[model samples]
Target: MPVIAVLALDGVPGHELTGPGMCFGTAARHHPHVAYELRYCTAPGFRGTGSPAPFRIDTPWGLEGLADADTVLLPGHAGFRDEPEPEVADALRAAADRGSRIGAFGTGTFTLAATGLLDRCRAATGRQYAAELARRHPRVEVDPEGAVVDADPFHSAAGVLGGLDLCLHLITLDHGVPVAIETERQVFMQLHAPAGAEDATGPAIRHGTGPHSLGPTIRWMEAHLDHPLTLNDIADHAGLTVRGLNRRFRAETGLSPLQYLLRARVQAAQRLLERGDEPVERIATRTGLGTPANLRHHFQHHTGTGPRIYRTAFRSMVAALTWADGKHAEPAEPDGPAGADTDPGPSGSADDRRAARRRT
Candidate 1:
């Protein structure tokens, strides 16, 4: 089994620590063949207590624990904005030199950025912090819209639940899709399943004072997914000019208003596909994608899979996992429907599609 070193710095968020442990631990229990030996390591001279509460973390591992790790995960800490300790940077650099995969969870990307490993590489942090990350580290290409970014040896995940996505991605790479999908279903209850996993929930709505908060506008957009909404309509509803809305949306959500609306439509389609047996043309009209061909094009472009295949594959997996006999079984292979290509298209990885959207 590969040894995974999870480094928890002072003021580490309690959830990030337990989240990965739960994910990897559940995978081990459910599929022993894909097991990983997980160890919690701390920075040198670090206090055992963490911020946001008064709880102590006692771990037997230290910086030295990363020496032989097959992978090292850095979760967010309260002081992530501050430059990492020189010793921590040196140890991380040394670990990278040893060919261990280094991943930054949420704001921990700051610490990885400090080590210069992520410089010139693409990284995804929380959308709220994407602008700041780009500003702070001009050399690192910050992907604001990506749920998770896999730049080979350097990986990063966006937002609070993004760590779960990163863990699933790692599992997908190590084992395969079936194990990762089962691990997600058994572990996280499918709450934050990797990007392609369909759900009713869309991207989080930002809440704040002044122009930054797009809660009302986002809700309006969601409510009007079936209607053809233009940029001016959205900007008018938000009481902002087109340029201002675009700028603010980019700053707050890391996506332009239209891009956000496009994602909302696609996500709405996902929910419909997952819940019903509607025809592709009817679903397209309902989601305002206009036509079936357009829906197929955009859905494939954004999600890396067509609607028919996604629905088939997702339902098959759900059925496989929900066996009545209380026995685990491999997911059923999705029989590709006519006109629905099983190929994910030329967009490459999900990360690449997200990057393409970011560029747009």
Candidate 2:
């Protein structure tokens, strides 16, 4: 289990503290086998600077909690303009020296910058505070647009909600895309969707055949994954020239048409591998990859693992989550080999898993 230590300071934003807690807590609920231990710590005599609300929060640990942390998060506080205590700075430095990942959000970037770890690194905070952040820390590159900047062990996000985005990114790093998506869906369900609508598993993408909307074209591409689709064919279907399609795709999806197609195929293959006992060659054929060798190359590129290994890891994780849910009398293990008699009992449909994976 990875340990996340949240450095709670005086006046820390309640949302900042709760955001990460909620994210990591959701991951634990869905994937207990790889859960993270969340620890909140404070310096001696510390009292949070209550803003949006007036309140006081007491923590269970001290600066020492950061010593063995896998990741340390610093949430925004009211006194961010002021320098952190010598002990706080020293503790952050020590954690970084030991290879712990450090993250900050909103004006908390100022506190992390004060520790000198962000020197010569790109960082972000609320857009309004970007100029002041750069002015105060000449050595640090501050992005005014407030995009999330990940400088290896040090990461920072732009605003309060950006803090949640940062936490979700960390979840993706620690537990893979599927787990992160599930956690994100859970969070959104609590925030936006009404009760009894939580089990919805439709593709988040909207579909339309009009020139202005690629949703329908993307959906078409997904449905025709087994066909050998050329850029020209896709462009023709979208009523755009090759160059126009490329531009529009990059603008809307951040991926070129062919890149999107390849990812779709890979995703299709992953779903099949997870849900059924199909041979690699058949899966490759069904997903339009042409050959098992081709599938191996692209699957490894996208997932950082071969199909067999990915299937094993994925199924084991699913089984663990299922067993933890008390859905079975005995904890189930993944079926042995491709042709074995195995039961993938009660795992949600491939569409559900795909929806969860693509939520982020």
Candidate 3:
């Protein structure tokens, strides 16, 4: 099991701490073997205050808790524009030197940046603060629109919601997409809905009326992901020319038609890989990537791993989750080539796809 230490700074956003806690806690409940031991630690002489509200937080551990952590998370706070305490900065540097992965959410990136560990690395913070982050730390490449930036052991997210994205990304890395998706649904979905109600509508379904509406066309594209599609095909279905489609797509979704198609295909493939037992080649065929080679190429390009590795990790996580529920099953070992693909982070649909496209 991995150990995660969340730094509890004064004025930390309540959601930043609770959001990751919810995600990691949910994963532990469903998959004990891959669970993480989460700790909340404060710097020496710590005086804690809540964010987006006024409250108090009392943590049990001090700076020493970061010594043996597998990962250290820094959450946003009202004082993000200010430098962290010297002791906090030193402790973070030591943790990074020891090779513990570090993650920052919202304004937390500022604290991490203050440590000088993020120099020459890509990172992100809320769009409103992105310019300021860049102005303050020119060595760090700041992305204004990215939801998440994974610079290996150092990761950062753009907003409060991006905190959940960062946590889900970490879960996906520790376990796999299956566990991450389950945890995500648990965190984001309504709990009181009827059993079958959730599965009845796919993510693409939207209820609205407008001239800039691409809802019907998006739903069509999602439903037909298994078919080989072209920009012209999408334009034709949407009753517009290719150029007109491109304008509408960029205006409404901030993605080109082809980019949108590719994302939809990748998302569909991920679902198939996570929930089914099909071979990579079959999944590729089903998702209209044409061949396993094509799937591997695109999957690695989009997710940073190959299809077989994704299947193994996802299936193993599913098995672990099921096992925790007392179901008897053996997980398939990850036997493919060493390099397997995983999602870049929390991304889906038009808005998420746009953010991902910008990161690439």
Candidate 4:
């Protein structure tokens, strides 16, 4: 059996934190050879404990509990911005360094990235934080697409409840499509099952076959976009004998790794500009794109509009999406029932699509 140690940090989104435990718990019962043994480590002062009694209780595990696990799962939480008192990062990084497969859900992706374990690795997080994560870290590659990403042993899901997608894929990959179909039929929720799986809930993935198949060096390059990285640096990090990572990167993101990084920088600059908190040069440096002139060039090329205008326009849209006469932001859709791509995250539909079109 493959053992999984879940670092049940506090403030993990209620469902995201517990969902993996439940999914893997079910797997343990449903399959003998590929069961997951889960243990939750208790940290006395973590954000996830604020939930009501049932959610914020004691666990049987401790930091040392992660030692023997084959995979370590980190659930997302908003509280990760603040450093933890315990040697939390050490435990997570240690497990990751040992080649244990790693998984993250919701904001948990942020924590994983923070350990620098995910440096030069392609990672994904909730849709809300994709731009922010990229800007702040400047190194990690975050896919905004809803599909789960598996690079080597690291599997990540985007957005809330995205873990369901990641978890289902894991079962299908290990147990075969028929077993996945059996499980899906028994379960009552809609899942984004990639193609080739007999019981997939969505379109199949036509590339890479699986996550672990991605190039190891490419993974490292995506993880370290923050530092002054060159193609040589990336190749060296991935332990690839050649000095060029461009071809593989082009294959992965439809652009060379540097091109992808620049594009990502532009996007990050745009997001921060919208927040109305920084100047263009600062935003450029922060995004790793460099210069007001350079930002203007790409910003104009990408959106057919200049940076100043984009930021002004985005700020206006933000105001309209949240406040009507200066009110607090409300749910994008409060009355909508559970469904596919329900909440696209704090934004306006008509304006957003229009803006997104402009970017494309």
- As for TM-score, the candidate ahead, 2 or 4, is 2
lDDT of all predictions, in order shown?
0.72, 0.73, 0.70, 0.58
Candidate 4 wrong stretches, greater than 4 Å: 47-54, 84-86, 189-360
Model 2 misplaced stretches (Cα beyond 4 Å): 193-360
In lDDT terms, how accurate is model 2?
0.73
For model 1, residues 199-286, the per-residue Cα lDDT tens digits are 3233343334454477778778988999989999999999999999998888877788888888878867876776578999999999
Per residue, candidate 4 scores C-alpha lDDT tens digits across 89-162 of: 88877787788888886667777787777788787765545655676666888776534677767877653342
Model 4: how large is the Cα RMSD against the reference? 18.1
Overall local distance difference test of candidate 1: 0.72
- Candidate 3 residue lDDT tens string, 1-360: 688999978777665677777778767654434568899897765566564545667777899999999999998776777788899999999999999999997778999999999999999876546666787899999986546788989988754442777887787777776667656544443222357654211323222236658878886887898887889899999999999999988876667878778876876787676556789889888888889888888888776667778667654543443233222111112452233221123223323422452453
Clashing pairs in 3: 305-340, 305-341, 306-340, 306-341
lDDT of 1 at 15: 65
Instruction: Say which prediction, candidate 3 or candidate 4, comes out ahead on lDDT.
Output: 3
Ranking by TM-score: 3, 2, 1, 4
